[model samples]
Target: MLKLKSPQKATMQITRWVSDLDWRLLLLIIPSLSVLVFLSLSSTPIDSFPSLRSFIFNHTLLTSNSPDFVNSLPSGVHNRRESSVAKWKDELLRSRMAVCLVGGARRFELTGPSIVENILQVYPNADLFLHSPMDRNAYKFSLLKMAPRLASVRIFNPKPLNETESQVRVLTAANSPNGIQGLLQYFNLVEGCLQMIETYQKRKNFTYDWIIRTRVDGYWNAPLGPENFIPGQYLVPPGSDYGGLNDRLGIGDLNTSKVALARLSLIPKLDSAGFHQLNSETSFKAQLTTQHVPYLTKRVPFCIVTDRRYGFPPSRFGVPVAALSSPGPLSGAKCRPCTAACQGRCVAGVMRSLYKGWSWTDWDNGSLELCNARDQWERGWEKIFDKVAGKKSASVRKKFADLKKKECVDDFNEMKKRVSNWEAPPPEELCGLGLAV
Candidate 1:
């Protein structure tokens, strides 16, 4: 109906229309092309993808230390990967380690030499950090003079800590001897050692690859092997879990250890997670899980040397005590050096009666022997300890029992000489902690 447009204008309009249509077509076609390419790539079998398979198997040693992981691999592949395994083990031995000892020196005379012999000397290069409360037993720590290296030692007089409302809501005093306050004190002891390690690292301008934390009251039956130093995971001894993970004897890389070692500092995080009425063990487990840290459990060759008594023929919730003579890596179970009260089928029957997660440990075969720890350590517990702990450890016990202030001062002085950080009271003050004024 209108005047006819020029041929050049009409041609230009047609050209613009064609360009828009081509772009719309491309939008529809490109996605389909991409889908087809993805389908084609995904159809290729993983076994045929040599580069992918090689990456998983080759880099595993740098990442994984789980024996379960190795066993899960193809049978023949494990044998071919032996060299990788050896290399990881070698790395563990050479890695810098911080061996942190925490708790009161209640049984330092008996436990100290074993720790020095099995843990400290076994990893002679590892620096030692000890944080303990000053008690009548504080003088016993003089045994640490035998330790090859002492990085830090803190012996402070303990005062009652003020409890927060969150601590009251989140913690339970059910099984603790000192109630919630007891747990707080123990937590402080552990966390304090971590603070010391941090200070030492800053002072020296170096980071430890691994941190090994154990109680001062623990008696080691064997050396802490290189296998326990998992690269990215926290290692804990199995069993004795009361609705949570074992809080005793933890080993890990510095990152994981930081979370594991912050026993007291992480309680607020637990409260935030809605954890209520948790005991130390449960609180400890909650701390790790809340922080998204991974942990693994293995049988460690140490037992807590406790003077506290537990019921024999333990009920569903009762604690089972072990005899030190048991040919075992007892894994931090409460133990005493005494004649076995239960063994063979007697042990099997009693152990079977107890809940595995609550109070029981792996006591299969003839590996475990029980103690009648109900009463005070039998009248002559010294001989029993000596007989089980051997002549060398026995001699150490005698030396501590007969310790003089002069000798204690001399011993601490010697230990101080080897230490890199001596953050403790003077040797004379430490030696005379329990002596009468």
Candidate 2:
């Protein structure tokens, strides 16, 4: 047992030990190297990486889903994203697109110019469609004159929709501000935009490759980036899913868009399937599911800017209102400007308290801020708005806030000159109703 080894024998023994160490290292490092290589090669289109994409896009919770990982990517992944986005933009440039805006112009004075600059101008080739109901504040829509293009504009006073038996059975009156009647009116506006697009295609003997349906009250903080144009998927903003997908904004190719925009026409189909008591969001999910449309969710760069009051530290069933300045796409969350009533750990506590399946939004990584909306928007909401929106947008807001009947009429006239397929009541009537003496 105490025998000493010869020099050559000891050397051979040491070489064997070194060889064993190398094998162990290879066993440990091989897997990690494979993973690194796989990730690096995943620079193809989204369709190329179905397994990884499928992982991010969960099966339950209303179809497929994915988050915008734009901010958190490593430098290589970030560059890859830019390359992917460039490809999307290239496809868009070679296609026809329609950008539809629906609903009332409640806060349009503040929201309109941003739409013109951020969306309409950004996709200057995409035709614009405006379908809004006439209201006392309708004069504010005159701001859309700055739009790069217009396919159609219909600002009409809505007659009450006769809620069919199917509508009554399927759609509940709860949570709707104006009840089932209100839902119908909103649905009509959404569907009406599709109808208008169809009519335009018929008139011009052409078809659109893409349809982007958004709201009139939505404010855009940045451009609707090219990355969202998934060929086979309907893209809706993430969060604010009130027992349904966010209906606030939708983007899709022509085939998927039809299934989405057919809000009213699909109700009969929903009723046939024995679905009832559905809210707008739930009904939206049902429509797409039944139609076999695949959908994707990404953080869109817009918010439904609202003046409606909501409670702070939103209760289990209550709505969480975001501050306009919250560095969010806000993703269709109702937002208003005020000193944040909640943020940081406060946001964490409040978000935890909310029903995640209900009116919850993404509040991670300090991307969200809250507004105390129990009362009216703060007394100096203008100053707060101007500060958040910066000088260029604030000047546009001031222009509309100071809009007179004469100036409003002038703007409409200018729009009439530029807009193709303009379909609406006269400028005088539109201005007259909103600015009556």
**TM-scores for every candidate against the unseen true structure:** 0.81, 0.84
Over 4 Å off in model 2, which ranges?
1-80
Mind giving the per-residue lDDT tens digits that candidate 1 earns over 297-325? 87889998889988777788878789998
Candidate 2's residue-wise lDDT over 208-235, tens digit each? 9999999998988888877677666788
lDDT of 1: 0.81
Clashing pairs in 2: 244-281
Give lDDT: candidate 1, residue 219.
Answer: 92
Error of 1 at 50 (Å): 21
